[model samples]
Target: MGVEWVKKSFLVILMMLLAFTMSACGNTSKAVQKTEDGKVIVDFWYALGGNLGEAVTQMVDEFNASQDKVHVNAVYQGSYEESLTQLRQLAGTSNAPAVVQVFEVGTKYMIESGYIEPMQTFIDKDKFDLSQLEENILSYYKVDGKLYSMPFNTSNAIMVYNKDMFKQAGLDPENPPRTFSEVSAAAKKIRSHFGTNVHGFSVVTHGWFTEQMIANQGGLYVDNNNGRSGEPTATSINGEEGQRWFKWLHEMKQDGTLGDYGRAWDDHRAAFLGETVAMYLDSTASLAGTVTNAEFEVGTAFLPTADGMDPQGVIVGGASIWMMTDIPKETQNAAWEFIKFTAKPEVQAKWAANTGYFPITKAAYDQDVLKDRYNEYPQFLTAVQQLQNTSVTPATQGALIGVFPEAREKVVNAVESIHGGADPIEAINKAAEEINAELENYKRVNQK
Candidate 1:
């Protein structure tokens, strides 16, 4: 062949090879297996890393080794938001994974997408006993008397404080603040005792904290019973509860009792670890890392409510496992098997002990491993007790708005505005109205 023909031929061959590789690689969560062992392949996409990822990898390896009929390929896709984005793009495609983990805020959107098989389908088809699951944890994902996904890793917000700082401030560490007013008082005391370098408390201007505060005060987040009775027509954040929360935060800031960390979750965490702040409200999911990094004795307590308002309950936070629809029966069955395995008390306990995410089921606590772990580190029990004490009210079940993530961002902006000395009532009202408009669009699109 001539030189020109030879070069063209090489280019053609290279293109073909690249195509083959791309086809074999499949989606972000799936890759072709090397072995032809007659075992079905099940791809699982998860959104955890670090120690939590290691714990999940162990579970997957154990599950794969336990069965010859199925093989699970676990893929770590960045954050929960990234995983959900990939899921939305891959749905109904041949390259889609068999299972995906989506964050709590994405729940309504996932349901509206109509791409996933309701976990209740498999549960009913297989007669899976759900009694072992924690009712409070399960309540958040259930809608219209059905669960669309499996509760894999559930958590809630709590107060994390430095007990040593408490003692130095002459405040009882065991009696951590139970309400927003108490938090303010404690913060003032700690700041006075520790001086200007150390703040009394710190909080990120995140929307989840806003949601949790409203729920704890037995207030609704959105209309239609926090979206349990029907689709939410509007959000309820501009009401009495929102005013109280933002006003308290403003007052705290004015008095140097609370540190402004803006929207960086880690900044507040670092504040806690560096002892820049004596206490802060954060996720129960943060227990393991907080305990490990803090030099002083770290303490845990239920997240504080507004003054004179006892905590009715806090909503479940964290993500859950969702199975995609229209996949092969064999692959779907295998995925369900892996999911069911993870739900087992043994696996749940292992996950809880390792990652500090609350186990989804009550039975997990009955496991000897978890019991021993809890006994060894009693801080874990605080979240467990909080979940147990939560009432099964619609508000506590969490708001299921289709535009939840957007609504949260709007709330965050409102918080920032309030921190900058804007009127709390005006900021909250503007956010609520804007979120209501978004909800209207969502309703039109979803036909709800």
Candidate 2:
């Protein structure tokens, strides 16, 4: 969920490759492992940290313990970008991990370079029911209509509110804001009710909010072939809608209703968890860890939309399990078994229940365990509904620049300009221009 934990990390790694490189859900990580002796060791590199990292390690440990045929060694790669560079460098050599968690945006590059193996082959060979996975999730990693990766922990944007602040503001805690006006109004109400003790809404003045606003308004994030990764060129998103969204945030930040970025991603979460902010826009996967530790009762709602526009469109955000090429078939098959095992409905339900990420398979949703979860945790259902209603529109397919993550950093820079009172349209345009330059360089250097 969010920007894709491993994805953004590995993207930085790739960014570090040139400049250098650069670069989820759930309460639980379910491991339905089988033990088969005298097999092989499969290396997995992940970029997640803290609880998410621990959960991943736990899953890997269980997977390893489950079978004698495979020993999956889990390693912590720096970030999405770092991992990507490692993957690229390891290529044509012998350092590639058997499995790497790549961001959704990197799907095309992996698919195109033929560095990663397709999941369909793994699926066919394993004989798992591919039908168990939701079509939208499956399509996320599909390029030219072929399944190239397997969806694992999936998440989407959701509104998180502080119940104490809501109650103090005389608003219904159970009914958090569902529209943009409501978001603004509620934030104002909370600010007045709590004085400077609490802020209403929090977001980094960066490309993240831009993407969220654009998606909610149904604006295309990229052009060409559904914004699939291998598109011929990068498109500019510095137009009217992007301007309006960034401008609004600029205003909010000025008015103090909006919050700023802390040191790291978790710092933002910590900001909310610390109760300095009343509402937060973040990955739905945070529910598992956040709710348990939050001082105030927590509430979650669908991401709010502007008036007159349906607030329904959502983009799939998270990393997928990618199998490597140029590896042994035994290792590939072993990796496939692990992947298939993880995708099973029973496994999916357990993982969903444990972690805040939505289960990628249908059986997980249909299971009695998940039914109980839906009844118990309404937030999970909200994410599920948004994801299921998802359309593979270009806007929702997400951007695919060669140095896409770097381009996003440029977007953050543009927003920083706005925070300093720079013109919103001009700032975005400048950012877009900078991004295009990076895009061109990537295309030229990584040209097929």
Which numbered prediction scores highest in lDDT against the true structure?
1
lDDT agreement with native, every candidate: 0.86, 0.73
TM-scores, all candidates, are 0.91, 0.85
Residue 267: error of model 2 in Å?
Answer: 2.4
- Residue pairs whose backbone atoms clash in candidate 1: none
Model 2 lDDT per residue over 1-448, tens place: 7669889999888766764221111111212233355557777888777777887787777777776678887899887778888888875335667788987667767776667778878666657676768877776676666688888777878777888778888999888887767888888888888787678888644466667678777776556643564454654477666776767766676777876654265777888988778888788777777777887778887777776777546777778989877666767777887887778787788778877888888878778877887787665676787777776666666655556577668888887776677877788888878877776787788765
Query: Local error of candidate 2 at 292, Å?
Result: 0.7
- Cα RMSDs, all models: 6.8, 10.8
For model 1, the stretches where C-alpha displacement exceeds 4 angstroms are 1-35
User: Residue 379, candidate 1: how far off, in angstroms?
Assistant: 1.1
Residue by residue across 181-284, what tens digits does model 1's lDDT show? 88999999999998998889877888999998888888899989998888899889977987888888888878888788879888899989999899998888
